[model samples]
Target: MKYRFALNNDIPNLVRLINNAYRNNIDKSWTNETQYVSGSRITQDQLFEELNKPGFLLMVIEGPDTRSKQLIACIGITFYETYAEIGTFCIDPSFQQAGIGKTLLGRAEQFLQIYNSNIKAINMYVLNVREELIQYYERRGYKKTGLIEDYPLDANLGMPLLDLNLIEMQKTLI
Candidate 1:
């Protein structure tokens, strides 16, 4: 098991991992209604643009399967001076319940620690409607910050739902 930052060429697998984690997985917090209504798709071009942005880190976990290549998990981070935002943190559903998601969260936290000396917090915004997801994060030591906001309608997130509220979760690294 090797852990490394993603390369420019890994965007395709990264996108697949994320989309599968939620929009496609049966046990995922995101249901068919959510994926269907949202049109959940991200193109390689968009991923490239996102990757080139400042303070964005894309990390992937890979290992050999007997028959083929596989993407086990991934996490993306957008860092700021005082804090960092975590997005698209997911493990393949096939790899779920195997501690891959926990490992990815640890990596995300480690990445955040590199920027701010105090590393006041690692933050994320999850769909407010995804109760199971929120509970998952809570179990991982992230507490609700009571900050809820809507996803941008024109944010190029494949497709947008009519109304979406995301609740913020924060974990203090120090």
Candidate 2:
């Protein structure tokens, strides 16, 4: 597999991959959010806007072979003054539980630290109900900050099936 920055042409595939990983009921994974949320995870237009942002990056893991390379996982990072925010992280359901997500996350952290010398920590938020996801990150050294952000109901990303809040987690780079 190859880890690389997403290109403009990658938006469509990225959109499908993200939505499936997050909202598809047929292919449920531990990370699936369909139980707590409904609707598309991301739209192409929104991704385009984010892609053009100055301090943002979307990384993907493509694989099998060069001739038929397919995106199996992705993560986005937004650089800040002293830290970076990780978001839109997903892996194709078939690829989960195979150590791919772990590797991709580690690489993303390493990439940010190498790409920007100023980043001292990495932050990400998980839905408060996603205990499995929260614990997964905790195992990787992220700590819950006890900061909760209200879920944006008007964001068009999805409609929450339950009252939800985003729980902030952070990992300080050493």
Candidate 3:
């Protein structure tokens, strides 16, 4: 697979892949949130707005199929003066557990290092109920910061099937 910045035309595909990765109705290869939440992970309009933000990047992993160069995985990174935030990360269920997500995250960190010479850390928030996902980040050198955030009431981000909170995790890259 090839990795690069997402383009304007990639919004629709990215939305589909992300929803599939997180929602139950679609082909959920892994990381399925169907048991806990319902709705699309994000909308094309939100993605388009995000893409237009300064220091906000959406990276896509492209498939190798010659006839259709599909977007197989994607993640978003937003830079700040001292640290960066990695969110909206997902891999098409078909590509999950194949080390593609790990590789993409590493490359994203490297990209952040190159983009900000003084960057100190990368922070992300994962659903507290997803213990597996929390462990996944912990194995990647992320540590819980003892902070918890309430899952917002925004329906566009998906309605929680149960009460949920977000756990903050950070990996210092300095």
Candidate 1, position 91, lDDT = 72
C-alpha TM-score for every candidate: 0.85, 0.96, 0.94
Which of the two, 2 or 3, has more TM-score? Answer: 2
* Predicted model with the maximum TM-score: 2
Q: What are the per-model numbers of colliding residue pairs? A: 0, 0, 0
Task: Residues 68-130, candidate 2: write the lDDT tens digits.
Answer: 668889999999999999999999998888999999999999998899888999999999998
Off by over 4 Å in 3: 25-28
Better of 1 and 3 by lDDT: 3
RMSD of each: 2.7, 1.1, 1.6
Q: Of the candidates numbered 1 and 2, which has the greater TM-score value? A: 2
lDDT assessment of candidate 1 = 0.73
| Model 3 vs. true fold: TM | 0.94
Which residue pairs clash within candidate 2?
none
**lDDT of candidate 3 over 43-131, digit per residue (tens):** 99988999999989998899878359699898899989899999989888877778999999999999999888878999999998899
TM-score ranking, high to low: 2, 3, 1
C-alpha lDDT of all candidate models, in order: 0.73, 0.90, 0.88
